[model samples]
Target: MAGNDQAACADGPDFGPLAIEARGLVKRFDGVTAVDGVDLTVPRGAVYGILGPNGAGKTTTLRMLLGIIDPDRGYRRILGADRPHDVAHAIGYLPEERGLYPAMKAVDAIAFVGALRGLPLKEGRRRGRELLEQHGLGYAADRQIRQLSKGMAQQVQILGTLVHKPRLVIFDEPFSGLDALNQGKLERMMHGLAQDGTTVIFSTHVIAHAERLCDEVAIIAGGKVPFAGPVDVARDRIPAQVRLETRAQDGPWRAALPADARHEGSFWFFSLPDTGIEPLLRALIEGEAGILSLSIERAGLHDAFVAIAGEAAARALEQEKPEELRR
Candidate 1:
């Protein structure tokens, strides 16, 4: 329904050259629809993101794409393959619920997971050791996962995902339990993967992470995608804002301001006018309004998310995180 041709196809579905494509993907659990007619396209080598809340069907959608679970209706393809298992060797996935053998050594755990992905045990062990050393976990290789810190354990899981050298990497709520430092590390890892021509796709409720790491994103709320596209396109969906402050917040210069301008705490804020700010600046100068400051705040991913999904949903996601995490 959302820009998808739902009609039956005679020649089968054409997913074009996309790394990932979903045509009217739908899922239901106990009569309740988890994913409702969603379609997505992730270009090759691009960092794509699914932005949504905890229960917004993000996990369900990802699971369906991975063939971990089948959709009730519609179809999905990955790396031009009709099923995930067909290209299973070409993909790496990190699930939201972290899992590892607590009694297993860090390196062994990684090697074991890699072996499952078709990598030889010896090769997996070699690559796993190198990855651990590169990620500053060299000394912990022989240590049991239970003996490692939460962050270190998480890093081990991430290394296992990469040991196979997959062409596409998918992360489901990768930032869920990490601290800011670990989150930063994960961001760098995603960048590194994309730089190596890996198509990275991650789902998270945190919009800031998407803004920092993703080239394209789809915003889902209440099991429906209200917006999806390039990061710049999402930002452009809302108008920019202008904030002005002056000693005198009145008189003829005030008349030049847009009707939507609102006065709050010795400042005037409003949507930036399409004509230009030059005319407004000139008017203020001529009227001797003593302009203290003027600035334009370009719409950002967070603003676009709020505008599209509403403040209630935004607040629900933000909660009361630390200032640094929010930034």
Candidate 2:
């Protein structure tokens, strides 16, 4: 079996090369397809993101890849293993639904999680304390999970995920509930992991987080990924845009605007074509159009999502609850 060969080839659950590779993954629930055929690849030492809206099958896909649930049809290779369970010891998973014993102290909870991942009790406790101190939560280490603030609890849970020093860390909506300050801390932690040659993959409904953190991203919508690749490639889906607010709405300057120019409120917005804006500026000047303000905006991940996934998905994303709530 491929799994047997892989197990024998490595001393442990080594990544070999890629941290994750899945192909033609499909899963259904009660006859309704939850995940369509999908392929995902994540390289070692990279920060990858699975981005989608609520109920978009991101969770289903991740579950299948992790071997938490069997796929209706597909195959996955995680950390050189034919199945995730074969390499479970190399992975640290933080599920979307976070739970900790309410009565357990923060440090003890972390050590318990580490123990579940095969770490020794004493080592787990030692690492837990160090992690808490490094993350500015040393004072809360003795506090009960229920006594800590939401942000403190979240940090404690994340520290537990890393207590075993996994080669690949997977987080399902790790930012689901946190304030801006805590979110920043999580971002820094992810970057640190990648710098240390640990692969990080996380699912998120929030575009800003992925845009800021991901080296590569997959945009899942309608139970499928319409786009997946480098973050820069996605941003390039749309060209730079120029927004101009002018006193004169009509005149030769009107002709200067691109046919695709969109009028929104007092400003006209149009893609900044490769031909450049010099000609447009001259035309506006010749037409005596009083330009109130002009600005150029680069395409963002949200814009790419709208272009690839459609306005409906983009609207849903904007309307989705703030990444703050119990999963």
Candidate 3:
């Protein structure tokens, strides 16, 4: 449904224009702040991720941006509309709490969702069937919701979200119940959506998924955003790691190593020198250190998250289950 509408930019993906913008957004529940001055700027046609641990206000922040609930403070704009609901027809939302009528056929269910977004019932049904066929669910089209597996049912709902061909799509914890195969399918779907100039946003505590799919991310902890920017920028906060194995350890090359360098077995590890690797390379070669293997490893999103949001937040991300499961 995505690539049919708009062709991707010629040179590269154009994430210049802003699709959603929020400033100093704050929300409270019973006087306890749920979102604290969260700010975000999501670019058009970009796949953006909101990363945080459970109870870190990611959902609350998304709710505020969608105008599902009024923020206690701050303002937001969606698709250039002052009120998000004014342009609701152009937006698709797959909330964390998934639900559909158990009695309805999968196609009928998808069509019904499209109808709510102002799509013609007849056209919706036609598109629903086509979508089902495209997503390898054609055999299940006539089947009732209750007849499908949990994953299949969720896929139906996701197809419903896209039936209207929304310009902007938001998914909250869409991967929670999905198997690895389904998760990969969803990732491809998000990529297709972005390539078609659709602004895609999703929230997740799983750093791996975000790292793989998101062009940019906002890392939240304790209801506050510690860092929000391009994934590369976040990863750049920590220095690259250097791993070196040499034939001779006691040489001039050893002196070139950083003060913080540590030896373990036959390898020496340390952060990449601020002066850069060229000097170190020259020293090693000139000193005849007999380099066996040398590697520079950049920090991953998980490491960056720990550095930015602290170890406690990272632990919460690893330990916390989905809200529904916890409940």
Q: Is candidate 1 or candidate 2 better by TM-score?
A: 1
Clashing pairs in model 1, backbone N/Cα/C closer than 3 A: none
List candidate 3 stretches off by more than 4 Å. 1-16, 321-327
Whole-model Cα lDDT per candidate? 0.84, 0.85, 0.89
Give per-residue CA lDDT, model 3, range 1-327, as digits (tens): 233422332222222489899999999899899999999999998999999998999999998888899999999988887798887877888999999999999999999998988888998899898888887899999999999999999999999988888888899999989987898899999999998888999999988889999999999999999899999999999999999999996876678889989999999999998899999999999998999999999999999999999999988987864554344
Tens-digit lDDT track of model 2 for 146-176 = 9998878888898888888888889999987
Q: Pick the candidate with the highest lDDT.
A: 3
Candidate 1 achieves a global lDDT of 0.84
lDDT of 1 by residue, 79-134 (tens): 88888898787778899999999999999999998888887899888878888888
RMSD of candidate 3 to the true fold?
3.9
TM value for model 1:
0.89
Give the total clashing residue pairs for model 2: 0
Model 1 lDDT-worst window of ten? 1-10
Extract clashing residue pairs from model 3: none
